[model samples]
Target: MNRVIKDTGSKYPIIQAPMGWIARSQLASAVCEAGGMGIIETSSGEIDNCKKEIQIMSELTDKPFGVNLPLLFLKDDSMVKFCVEAGVRFVTTSAGDPTKYIKVLKDAGITVYHAVPSLEGSIKAANAGVDGLVVEGTEGGGFKSPVEVGLLVLIQSIKQNLDLPIIAAGGIVDGAGMAAVFAAGAEGIQMGTRFVSSA
Candidate 1:
């Protein structure tokens, strides 16, 4: 079985990828109730809000949910410790080199997944021992590669290069998009814009 689904308990093999200000407790909880893993974003380093959001989510579903911590944006591990203490088992790191913190996360018994925008980033995260990878492309909204590589093209470029479970992101808005990426070798899909727009 794919570790993504095993760890997340997402029935649809999909993740409601954290979208900074947009993916707060309301939208995230809705996705979790819908059978997909919802993620709370901590890009602002707002640990208190994250705590409140996680609390609300816990009230909505028993399924495993996740927290997204963009390592590049935070100054310390205070939030990480909060997640650990809060019993958050799954975390996704993006926008920074996660190597220095991977051990901390893993040692805390958390499953770490890194969101990467290129093959180089993917390999680094894989070597950093992130349990999985959210391989996003330029087509996705928010911070991304200016290289303009399409999602499938980026997936194909790095899929065979790494041993980690790959969760394809960007350019996925519907079932057809999901099926196409799976055929392209992704173990799961993470969609942001589609979910945010719907909310």
Candidate 2:
């Protein structure tokens, strides 16, 4: 198994990225049960609902799973505290400075992954000591910016500069695409559309 999968205890190197608003426990646990890393989206500011869904995920699968917390959307530490108390071991943070929560999560023995859309962001995240980086290409889907890097370039650049595990995200919806990213030096692939579409 790839380091990313092994680190998260998933049977496969595929990660179902928490695709904004739509990512919930049902699909997240299903992915986990299917041997892929699954992530619950908790950026909606609904702490209660997040806990409820996490509880549901816990009941449905014994496999490890994670949560996606968009720093830009989260207003406090409620969700973070909740996950830790609930025994979540992996967390993927996007769209904000990771320094704020990276230490908190790491101190509690949690692996943290930050989604990066630019080389600068990748370097910064690596410096912050993240467990991994999810290089989200403009092609995959993310914050709309005139400056968007595609997976090919972003993954290569990150691989060339960073030693941490890399998970490729964006524009990949199948095995061929996953293989291409892995060949490009990514340890895993974070897929959203394939599962979201099927759901």
Candidate 3:
């Protein structure tokens, strides 16, 4: 079995990007129902509303889903505690050091993937003990690294250095794009722009 499928528990090796307020239950549930992993976003820092969204996801789709923790945007660890207590099985952390909450989330039995923009970041995340890496390239929308490495190059470079399951995120939209990433050595794909239109 694909490690991405084993890690995410989604039928497809696809994850809907957790885009701020837009990545709420309504959008996430649809993705889940379509057999892709849907992720609720805490990046918006609307903690209470995001929690409500997570609950709504349970009622909306029984399919496996996830939540993203944008460490730079988070004001506290309350959301982490919430996910742990709520029994969220999967999570992706970005915008800060992966080492900070890795132990707690892992100890809770959560499968954690950290988003990284460069080879150095990917290596650091792997060393920090993340289960996988969401390798976001320069083409990806929203926040990005100062270094502008493209998706294919980033995925290939990281794959050569670290033997970790990678969920490539960037300009991928259709099957052709997915195939391109897979050929570049990524095990899965994460789509944000396409899903924004989906929502």
Is 1 or 3 the stronger prediction by lDDT? 3
As a TM-score, model 2 comes out at 0.96
lDDT string, candidate 1, 119-152, tens digits: 8888888888889889898889888767677889
Better-scoring candidate (TM-score), 2 or 3 = 3
Model 3 bad stretches (over 4 Å): none
Selected candidate, larger TM-score, 1 vs 3: 3
**lDDT score, candidate 3:** 0.95
* Error in Å for residue 129 of model 1: 0.7
Q: What's the best-to-worst order under lDDT?
A: 3, 2, 1
RMSD of each: 1.3, 1.2, 0.6
lDDT of the candidates, in the order given: 0.86, 0.87, 0.95
Better of 2 and 3 by lDDT: 3
Among the numbered candidates, top lDDT falls to: 3
Q: How many residue pairs of model 1 clash at the backbone?
A: 0
Least accurate 10 contiguous residues by lDDT in model 3: 190-199
lDDT per residue (tens digit) for residues 52-170 in model 3: 99988889999999999998998989999999999999999999998999999999999999999999999999999999999999999989899999999999999999999999999
